[model samples]
Target: MNPLVSVIIPVHNGAHFLPDSLASVFAQEYRPIEVIVADDGSTDGSAEVAESFPGVRCLRLEKGGVSRARNLAVAASAGEWLAFLDADDRWFPRKLTEQVALGEACPEAGLVLCRVIHRFSVDIPEWFYGPTDGSAVTAYEPSAWLVRRAVFERVGGFDEARSLGEDTQWLSRAWDLGISHLVAEEIGLERHIHGANATGLIQNRRVVFDILRESVERKRARRAIR
Candidate 1:
């Protein structure tokens, strides 16, 4: 039997993009997968959109942040592996199949990351960016991840205190615990960049800085202990 994979999508007022994302999930070539749409108090019709899809489990929650919604979905899900997708992002048809293959090949890997292509809503001048910058930011997004449920549990899910950079914090904690990660060369995710993206919000910038500072301190403490 194929190992069950649970795909979790946490959204807040994401009705506009939820359908496309759900379609991508439904189009997956893999079998025995469950899709969990965690609606984080969306005033829009995000819950209705999620419920419109057959077999999709929609979990309604108060206006908690993305981390809280994801944590709740994972807690209610039953799967050996967990795959996360942002409401505005999409997975390629063979995404799950390829990730599963990679996981099987690297049994020691606790997490598998796939290459992602970022589609920007607006074009910027080529001269304005460097090779290391621009749409490459999607490289570190949680949407590209397929992780073992046990390892996720061991890392204690995402940090609810962080409104932004929660994925980074969670991954950092996982790495600190010596959890192995494998990167699949195949591009499996398409991240849509838009004006309203959380990363672009001014308040999230401060949250990002706080997360970075905490990460640096944790690293320094680990080094001192060693």
Candidate 2:
């Protein structure tokens, strides 16, 4: 039997790109899925755009943070697999279909990540990171991964305190938990570059990355002790 997948998209003033993101989700060939839009106090028309989507459960929250928004969405989701997609990024039509197929092939693998193609206005960059034999991949976008819901619950949801780098931090923790498995595929995801995105802001707020580094080091230290 195919596993149910919950697609969680956390939006913070993502109105401009929300429609495209939602459309990508709707186009997924995979069935038995629910789309949850966790809106984190969008002052823009994000809420309105999200509400326009039929059957998409929109969980509105105070202006906490993206991690908080993601946690709220995860709590409301009822899928065995959690597939997260940033509002500004989109998947190919075969994204979910191919990911779930990979999951089925290796039932023991807790995480599966695909290759990504970066699309800027000027040019398109083909990026691939994995072993030559395709053992595992290094560095992955959150949009490229399909993780087991239980693994997320056990490791705890995204760190609510961290202002940025939450996706990388969470994936690192997952890797530390000895549940990481990767499958390299050309059916890639497209990462859109835009001004409103959080990447620049995250770098500006160096303190967030500092916090993330400390947490990661501490996790490693604890593991070393055992």
Candidate 3:
């Protein structure tokens, strides 16, 4: 089905990469799309960079967090489907085009995720690679996901309380409600991990592990209740 897809990009002091990310969104082969750049109190002139593009709405908000920035952008958007993109990442030309078609084919899917291509900077250690060849990484990344607008209202937006793993947490709630996901094999996003990414790559492995462990405990508690 052809529908208006609202692309929400949240940024904080990412003037260096916002241009590339916005360029990718503009390069999408899909039509009827709206782009909203949520600037989470960036000191690096990110708002100006986003405003340089025509037809792109730039939202100026306090330094709340990525989740808050995304939620605010979603609230301001006017699309039937919502797609999240971090300021430092980019989408392939057929990202929305392919995902939207896949969504139509899999009508039962609450969200559609495409295969992600990872690019690592020299700073990120080689041992951190998911695969030996480092061909790819997580499928649950928001950049790879195209979610239904209703999913947010149903499962609620990303957890503003938690600084990390909020996207995973929000998506898990939707999955627990029997909302299936359509993971498209087509590569449609380029995720950059430069020791620190707006998406999720913290150099401190222990902190990341703790965040994930919290999710696991919550999941076990839910299972126990059932």
lDDT of 1 by residue, 81-197 (tens): 999999999988998998899998888999998877767675633422223243332356789989999899898979888787788788878888899988777778887876666
Clash statistics: count for each candidate: 0, 0, 0
TM-score of each: 0.88, 0.85, 0.88
For candidate 3, which ten residues in a row score worst on lDDT?
198-207
lDDT of 2 by residue, 1-226 (tens): 7889999999988898899999999988888889999999999978789889997989888899989999999999999999999989888888888888888788788888887665554222222222333232333767887988878887789889877778877876777777767664756577775544556566666855675677679777998999
Residue 188, model 1: Cα distance from true site in angstroms: 0.4
Best of the candidates, TM-score: 1
Model with the higher TM-score, candidate 1 or 2: 1
**Which candidate wins on lDDT?**
1
Measured by C-alpha RMSD in angstroms, how accurate is candidate 3?
A: 2.6
Ranking by TM-score: 1, 3, 2
